[model samples]
Target chain A: MSGVLTISQPGNSVVTDLGRFRGPRYGLPVNGALDQFSARAANILAGNEDNDPLIEITALDFRLRTDTDILVAVTGAPVTLSVGGRTCPQWEPVSVRAGETLAVRGMTGGLRAYLAVHGSVAAPVLLGSCAPDTVVGFGLKLAEGTQLEVRRSVAPIRQPYFDLPLFRLGLSRPEFGTELVVDVTDGPDIDEFGDSAGLLFSSSFTVSGRSNHIGLRLGGELPERQSSAELLSRGVPVGAVEVPSRDELLVLHRGRGVTAGYPVLAVVTSMSLDILAQARPGHTVTFRRTTVAEAAGALRTATRQLENLRAAVTTVFGLLGIGAQPQWHDLAPAVGS
Target chain B: MPVNAAAIEVHESGDSALRVVAVDADREANWTTVHRLAEWLESSGADGVYGAVPTYDSVLVEFDARSTSARQVKAFVQLGLRQLGHADTQVRAPREFDVPVVYGGEYGPDLERVAGQQGLSTEDVVRLHCAGSYVIRCLGAPAGSPMMDGPGFPLPVPRLKDPRLSVPAGAVAVAGRQAVIAPATAPGGWCVIGQTPLTLLNLANEPLVPYMPGDRLSFIPVPAADFGGYAGRYLEPAR
Candidate 1:
């Protein structure tokens, strides 16, 4: 049941799952796939559950050799994917023969890409997930010569051409235009900045090189706190836009610590988190104020799309006379939901 | 009487989370109420409640927005507050620990600077620091890192303007009026006064963290030569 996928060239990749959702209670960050939509899409295409462990490659140069025939899919930023010298398409399932070398090279758009394989990638699960959290010293950062043990699933599905409509609609790529506009809702400490809270939406910030999974550090005009009193440390959710003492803003991400002391001006909407995840160093970003109702609506729509994807996958499996994995239906709602 | 619903300010953290903040003036009372509320919410068989995190002055309740709304979470919290009316919440007794520490020298490089800032001799600084009983305010920053609050020094020591690249685990440090022992080697600004031999966060142990919020902590100064024995003894499982 177990097969090995040897990393011929790891590039900048890490093993990540949907994230460790329940770890925050124990003061652990909910580290997961930064571009969750792309991760899920890859999982769906590979005939795996949405939360199955996958490879998150940043600045793609990943190469792997499979020890057994494996169903695989690549999603997220547009990249050149090749298997045994034959160019393969992104955002669709592809089968690779045993000992075939699959290479993903030169991502053109988004900063990160997801490579999901059929069946579970057997990794040590800390807390409840296999997501690599570098901050917590958990999980692995795949490198050249790394061997990933995978439990091969025996599904009967064999479709030559299966394309999801959502993939054609540019749903996989992050919105990385000249200016990335992210939607945010007012945070608990919004009023602490007084009238300057409006500055959060108005100011344009450049993502600093210091940015990582922990947070996206932005260099720009920071909103000044009207009150001189210090804020008590409290639980901060992922996507919290925290303004510290320095002239920089930090948008906490999936790998953020459990608690933070800086005043959080706004929280990025769940739907817009994927956009932030793809923001590379030097990208200019601006926030747009949105209401909770609108944010919730956006999240609901995204969840429904994933649900549709799940159904579509089930249909494809059924049409091909393959049994749909029951675990695929257990896809949890995206962050905050 | 139960704290009035109006007394607590509910702020929407995001679409799916709400932060219920206690009035800032009464630190102890506010923290107590928040802790009790958090305990109640965790114990309650309420649908859609993801989890509640209690801090010094607030409880952030994260709910499943797919099934529950922010408004509904606030209402549930208000109901819990009402139910707590007039009843003194029986909190678990604070667990007291005598942490053996080796002060000054290699374990704590900032001890001399801390002593100088306090206008006291190095011996006197360690004596005063170990004298006060500290209370764990929260476990945060890093997993199982206890943030404890206690009596302040004669002159409060400020956090390092330039934080250290890496502070070793078990390095007991002070910043503002709070004290913390690093759970893992991490970059921090706190002034390190001593290092404890006890493992603060051993995942292999039955209880991962040695202390939780509301626990009492007191430092015991020990000779550096005896540090190894204490470290080994603390790591031993109870027979």
Candidate 2:
């Protein structure tokens, strides 16, 4: 059944899906959840469409009171999730009774946590997505006292709470730590760095506090250019490692601009992008060089894993009499321009 | 090289996108080639392709690798480019839009600074800014921010070396012969000249933005009192 959730503690959260699609034509960036793998896992566990909207809570505590019974899953970095003061398991669906309060005490591992309801978190859709993009003025923030609608096209979940946790499909979670060995492929302008091109991979950089959704500002040995010539403006893809005139090197994310003028030295791989999403400010980052073929392979593997999860979850939902099933195709995090 | 007379190159962007770049050409020719390719991809009904974003000298073709690999999309794009070269047809004219701006006040804090830099009065700065019909060259980065090109000042204006950390949204600024509007609040380095009240992007309004690349925009000076009336309204272009 459909329900309402009132945010008691927002905790820098926003509703996100695969992000706003087909936005580049209108000069909008593709902004969605920072970690695609975790978001997909949560969606699969909750038996919701892969692109359904979910709450992305960032590095803080959150609390919400519900008006009806629903199944939910918390993914992304490890966190202490609770329903009515009793701790609940993450990465798996748990039923919450009507009028019970759900809470995320704090993130124990990574920087962001995702909460996916079995029905899906409902928000106003703009263009093709309901993802909150402040820059484009699409959806608003999930602040305290905001009433959120939890919608599902199917009937209310009918499975018993005791039988739900039996089908725990194991999915490997990405390791998080103070230091990260990020994989990257060559960008279009790698040769422009001359001798400094090698330094980009060899040097250990510190993520500056100024870093945010747009990109991560790295402080370390700067990649010096061989020429003083100005680079012409061109399309800047997400994950491009740009070396601007400033001292910091930039690793663009989903929220970066559609185009830029800085020299690109490398591009983070699609699989590794999920790891970078959880990287905190002041964390040590070391670049590991890889080929485009390898990068593309990693992306393929991620999609395949999700497909397997979708298949397993489909059978489980069918057995439980739940109608909604996961459609993993086109669920991959959109490549930002 | 497959495209006759046009020097265009397509490079893989990470694993999910491909960038079509123009090689060794003037700004006009570069943009012309990129925009044509972007338009072709948008209208070609190509599957697995999401959208193409045309910038100053390139077009970023974003696609879904799951449904179709970059290799397949790249092949399709190459074939489309060859066909585009064979036809070499010009696109329809861009729509014209009049952007309402309030010059030289709180809306445009650097209007006086820009005038002083150009050795002209604030009135001259505003007059000269509104004199030329500009074209939206590209959009990106922050949000729906657009960089425009036009018959600008006689001399290129230098950017604020110590750039403002937080330039207000709708602020219109210029640098060299290029102009840009801050679609939202962010840092800016260009010399501010005026501000427009028309929202550059709002999904509530259909078509998202009234104009796209190649569209013409001319600024119409309005009193600060009238700026409020234009607020919350999308920038609708006049055909």
Candidate 3:
């Protein structure tokens, strides 16, 4: 079977991974899946590596048709996932025959969803990643009728996708909705914000439409600072919450710059990034203060869950006779029939 | 100036990264040391440490938290900190860049405004900018945007009260005695007085921007008609 997927209705879809390795040092933002937990879940369920390139569909109306039989999964936000008119539950692997239409629509919860096909996106890898950053001229957005070249392995499935008696998999996915309470630790320059620092936790800020992979802009009651003094530009992390002068509060994300001029009022916990990334315009956002120890523990727990997930998915893939090519996994090389 | 652990304050930048602020009263000295520390960490093969980004006052070190704990990464950072300013470590040689610019008109929309603020003719402002020596203070956001010192014109001009929503890439801008070339189209507050046709930072040419801190810089005016000739060429820094 020809391994190709044609975009029938591309809704802001782009190839993304964990972004380029060490991208910040070269002035490139880490342009990857905003909600990584969902991305990994989609991949694991599809019998692919966690960080493999996959399609990240934003908002709604993302539809594609497969040119070959493949195992796939859709995760992130509560969405209507339909394959050839058959509705399927998310986070579960499904077999799609050639010429079948896979549609994801009516996202009720999150703003972005991850679609992992059991194939590799045939996009040119720049600096160790297929993720595109328009600022750097790396890759382009997927267009309607554009056929994405995919490399597939001769993986076998026991039966049809809709008829498979698979157990529903439950994992620790962040709650996605219109409202979000993000956990944050102390930022490097928290002291300069003065008593106004409490304003961040006290007020609810509405997400702005201007937000993107770079950062999320929140508009609401402005927090005044004690100093108008010039702070030298410094390297900032992705989760840094910045207070730009006379502007809205900005939470830096994956596509944020390595450095900025704004003063950081708080730093969002890494575990909360998945929830923060899915926030849409007009979404109400509140902050919760947390200790550093708790933040690290959250990540530790998530890491262990993913490790166990990989083991479970890999075992199931073996039982179903779905094996990847030598390139994907040499230890379990597939005998392409 | 001696670099010490006490002089550097490490703050938690999310769970996976650390923001190390170098406390030095002198801005130039602070950035120079920060740049040195970043270069050392990169050139050496440090385990678990991903990358270190240096700016005017601090460094952000992002690491693989799954393999390394925050305490382990912090210890690695401390080890790297101790290696700074040592005579044994090879230092990056500073170079010079002659950036070509097309001043005035569409390329420099604020040429007239900058001239008026400085109480001089636009030609004088251009000439002074061309003659003034500048140094890249740091490479930063929006794709290695070079923040620089010495605009070559008089007066430490204040930034725009309302920053322009979109400053085009390659636009030569100045604010508060500093000059910058927008590496990409982004929101900025600096006065755009000119533009460079040469590619400042491109992955195909060089991953890192050609010039770094301590590099000498001076602008050269190019005829508007000849601007197209220099487009797409890499910025070649010379010693």
User: Residues A160-194, candidate 3, lDDT per residue (tens digit)?
Assistant: 58676574556656688787999999887888888
User: Order the candidates by TM-score, highest first — what do you get?
Assistant: 3, 2, 1
**Candidate 3 chain A: minimum summed lDDT over ten consecutive residues — where?**
A328-337
Model 2 residue runs over 4 Å out of place are: A153-165, A324-337, B1-6, B24-26, B223-234
What Cα-based lDDT does every candidate model obtain? 0.79, 0.79, 0.80
Q: A1-337, model 1: which lDDT tens digit per residue?
A: 2367889999999998988766665667778999888888889877788889999999868899986667788988778999888788788767687778999998756688899988757677777788986644678888888888766644323444663322232333344564788999999889888988888877899998899888899998888888878678898888899887666898988888888787878999877788888888888998999988889887787777767776776676565544445523222222221
Residues B142-171, model 3: lDDT tens digits = 788877876656787778888888888788
B152-206: candidate 1 lDDT, tens digit per residue: 6787688898899888888999888778888777778899989998876665542
Displacement of the residue A192 alpha carbon in candidate 1, Å: 1.9
Instruction: Give fnat (model 1).
Output: 0.51
Best model per DockQ: 3
lDDT digits (tens) for residues A40-71 of candidate 2: 88998888888998988888899999877677
Q: What docking grade applies to model 2?
A: medium
Model 1: interface root-mean-square deviation in Å: 1.8
Per-prediction backbone clash count: 0, 3, 0
Root-mean-square deviation of Cα positions for candidate 2 versus the true structure, in angstroms: 4.9
